[model samples]
Target: MAKYANGHLPARDRFAHWRELLSGTHAPMTLSSERADDFLARQHVVALGEVTVWPAVFPPVTFRRTRELIRRSDPESYHLTLMLRGSGIADWRHRTLRTSPGTFHTSDSSRPVEIRSWAERGRIMMIGVEVPKAVLPLPRRLADRAVGLPVPDDQGVGALLSHTLRRLVRDLPEYRLADGPRLGEVVAGLTATVLGQVTDGESALPPHVHRETTALRVRAFVEQHLGDPDLSPALIAAAHHISTSYLHRVFRAEDVTVGTLIRQRRLRRARAELADPRWDGVPIQTIAARWCFTGAQFSRSFRTAYDMTPGEYRGLRGGDGPGV
Candidate 1:
């Protein structure tokens, strides 16, 4: 989620700003607060393709998910929120939970709930994960057990999950647009691991399934960081805590090397950008720099792959370019 600087809104527009931002980020609902006139909030959003990790700070407010809201809207995915600062009291699924920093909780958009939040000193801070129910690798009944339940950050699976989410947010600078979907897979897998444990140990994914799932996570991480320029077999392996040899071996099974895929993806992105009218004002050198390519190298590689200079290709508007 990108940051919505509500503090910048005018007094007359503060309510509208906050209202739109909250509803857009989470589920559709109503917001109320005596201090709406002075509400201050912002968020950093990490969209991992299917999973979305959102960290936000807000002033005191009441967010309600009413029966009418539920009835009128299509069901959204489940959300897991870990409070980093401030606190909240939630009424959901016939239970009330006092949420504080170092505590996490789950909620279903399909259900009716009320959350009254209070600031710690002067602000409320939290991290939220949105996971589609269909992607979770668990039975529906077992997954339902987690909704509305508070899991402490230092205990059980919550500890690992909370830690992972924080790390992901902190490392946002290292991620790219392609990484969103891969990270989404990682979030879903971690969530499934936690939810699976909550129901019963035996209910967790089988060992083989777990390995396959983890492999997908590793691949996603690599793809997400592919544009780093420093991205290499060793770097990719180190980031995921795996051996370089293992990385090579695994990618071999896919019939392509990591380096080859990175080069191809970079070229594809560059080609797509060059062909699009939106990048028409962007200079060829500027575009090359972004993808870690120099003027000569980018020209040579692109011509070999697509048979045209970057500028010539751009001029063609993606049709009937130079062939000789």
Candidate 2:
């Protein structure tokens, strides 16, 4: 019999092939079951019908059903089960998990495991993300040790990733064709984050991956407009298709500010020119203008920052200084 009686297939196809396969109509259940099996195989578990994901402080899942799922699916993915309702017990080769609300349990797909729910009858939310065995960074020797480790939902990168995933699932259908690439990236990042947590920081899965992926674009935009005297927050934001507030937020996260960082960089370049003996009498205004600085204002900020006026600092450095 199919475990998922309500959600496994669309309601319209409830009476046709889907229901027939669940009833075990065909022999060996191999050929006829291939479709359902293939679909289930993609994920680590399956049900004869639909599975309702509820939002309680904690989540719940059927222990017996969970065991059946493990035995039947035997996949290569990872499962993170968060108990939200009542309670439950997870039995593995040698350990037992007494699950409660707000607590989580993890398991690998290649093992034999059992999950038993508490007597009160509870429900839980299960998050599943697949990682190929061959690509797992940690040695098998230590991989299993992380199983059943409770993921605290309060803080840290894990919490951030968990929150993002929960929000994504809640708005799953909104991810359509136009958003496929972004959705895929989000999925990859979230999966990496979970893996890193499971492996105890042995993985390089963090939000920085996304940041780096787009860093080149940011750098290019800033460089191309290096000569704009008004190359300020509003200009940068408009060029990058983001809000000025968001641009500032990104710079702040990097331990700098949009305007301050740009000004510092510009001053550094200007100082290099001032030190060049070739431009010995280039005029302070000329040097500042060459670097896209606002003449007098640049000199003021530069002096305030470096503790000396531009010309004075220039003469002290004796030309031939830094480069591009």
Candidate 3:
């Protein structure tokens, strides 16, 4: 992983360093800022096989990929920019689109484009992937449709991709070189599904890919909604637009039922809290309620799952995982 930022530097040199950093991370582009102080930004990037996962923060600036610039320095890559903060407008492939937090858009380096983050645009945070054009297995037509198009990251494949990318960025430093291939599979699978769905070509994805990838999405949804007591197999299936039977069929491959998975997850979270020093003074009932458990029911499940009561567990292990 690589990290870059300008701090404790003269205002005049900040913009210069920012430009150099941007060009080094991405393809060279025309960058400018009207603010005398420019903007403080930081970038953290990791290369996982052919995919590059980058998370960054920046202030308002205007960036343009003019025809001349593209012709002279195109990288022949596509960047899927997931907006984490603020908003901006991108003019690419004859389209002007507005993007906000929790949404993403693709930037094709081969094409001329203009993106503006105005003075009033506020701070920005985003995660983007750099995938070489030649290595992207997605169909050209489908890929083109997603270029410069705003893709929703709040649900479905988009949500899965969003979560996976953020997690990868957070955990990148801990990964080994041999894990690159596995990471590549994750990036490709989620990227393909998101693109296919956005372009109305979801049928083009093979059955195994769609099923396995959607299974991950199901898991993501479960983790995200675990706090809701109403979370159930039927609701989970509905959220992903699959039937309850289909949900069970796929989950069977994991050797666990939906109810079992939910229970285990809730129990695990409750256990974490019980062991956490920060929650040391918190009532056992409150911790149970946080994970949708209650009273004796919570204690019984806690004992059954861990062979000890919540109070005993907290007294014993204090903040840790599984082994407790």
Candidate 4:
């Protein structure tokens, strides 16, 4: 991840520095801000393979990509913007629309477009994903339909995509650079699914993308129900209205069975708590049970996975201080 802030620069030079930084990171564009005299903004960017996720906060501004700029160079990518704390207006293909928090707006780098953003109180904040056009799993005509359209993110697949992007931005520091390609693949898959659904062209996506999308949804369900002792392959499949055998097939692409994934995630959660100094007062059995593991089962599994008994591991981490 890379972070950039203009606060360190002199007030007079801040906006210019931001412009240069924007040109280097994103597509070339002309930026004009009423607060340019002392612009305050910061951005964090994470590169996932060919895609980049950038979350930024800045004051009111207008961004324009002109025909002249496109003539000079084009990244041939689609920029998807998710408004987190503000509202904006986007103009593209002779269409203009307003976007608010929990909504999405897209733009194509191959064309000229203008976007003006502002907030009622503080600065505008948003997450933007730059995906290569050629990598999109939809036909060009269908993908084009999504540009400049206001996509409501409060329901259905749009909501899932919105949550995924937001979570990625929020928990980005927890991920290593080596995880980029795989993470990028997941993001690209979800993005394709959302775009296809928005354009009423879901049938256009390849079979693998659909499988991956279903797997992603299933994993999210598992995460939400991790503490349920009854959680199993049958229950998970039933929740999604799919058969257990089919669920297994879906996870075949992940090279792990559904049950194993659940167990791994549960153990990981328990282990994290066991190692935390704040959890020192919590009993090992209680922590294990909190993650849906029986006392004996938790000890066995933790030793198998981490090569140490839970008590020993907790003691090593100072979790065995005084509180028992």
Return the top candidate by lDDT: 4
lDDT of 4 by residue, 1-324 (tens): 899999988999999988887776679999999999999899988899988889999898999999999899898988888888888888885899898997888888888999898899879988889888888777788888878777778776677788888898878879899999888887877887788888888899988988888888888888889999999999988888889888899899899999999999999998898888888887888888899988899989999999998888888855563322
lDDT of 1: 0.75
lDDT of each: 0.75, 0.52, 0.80, 0.86
Compared with the true structure, what per-residue lDDT tens digits does model 2 show for residues 1-324? 112333465644433443333213111111122122222211112211122122222122232323455456554644555443466677775777776655556666666565655424322334433444444444555456667666665454455545554665566556554564454454444444555566775444344654532343455456657677778888878876778887766666567777776777788877777777887767778878877866778778887988988867876866433321
Runs off by more than 4 Å, candidate 3: 8-11, 36-39, 119-122, 170-181, 227-235, 252-257, 276-309, 317-324
Estimated TM-score per prediction? 0.64, 0.42, 0.80, 0.87
Off by over 4 Å in 2: 1-73, 119-122, 125-142, 178-185, 203-324
Best by TM-score: 4
Better of 1 and 3 by lDDT: 3
The pairs that clash in candidate 4 are none
lDDT-based ranking, best first?
4, 3, 1, 2
Question: What is the lDDT for 161 in model 2?
Answer: 47
lDDT measured at residue 106 in model 1 versus the true structure, 0 to 100: 81
- Total clashing pairs in model 3: 1
Candidate 2 RMSD to the real structure = 17.8
RMSD of each: 10.0, 17.8, 4.2, 2.7
* C-alpha lDDT of candidate 4 relative to the true structure: 0.86
Model 4 residue 14 CA deviation (Å) reads 2.4
Q: Mind giving the per-residue lDDT tens digits that candidate 3 earns over 1-324? A: 788888667777887788887776778887887653756788887777887878988887788878887778877887888888878889875799887777888888888888876434566788878887776667767877778777898876787888888888777768898998668767876887788888898787667677678678778878889999999999998887889999999888778899989989999998888767888777888888888987788888889988988878877864343332
Check candidate 1 and list the clashing pairs: 1-45, 1-46, 48-180, 49-180, 49-181
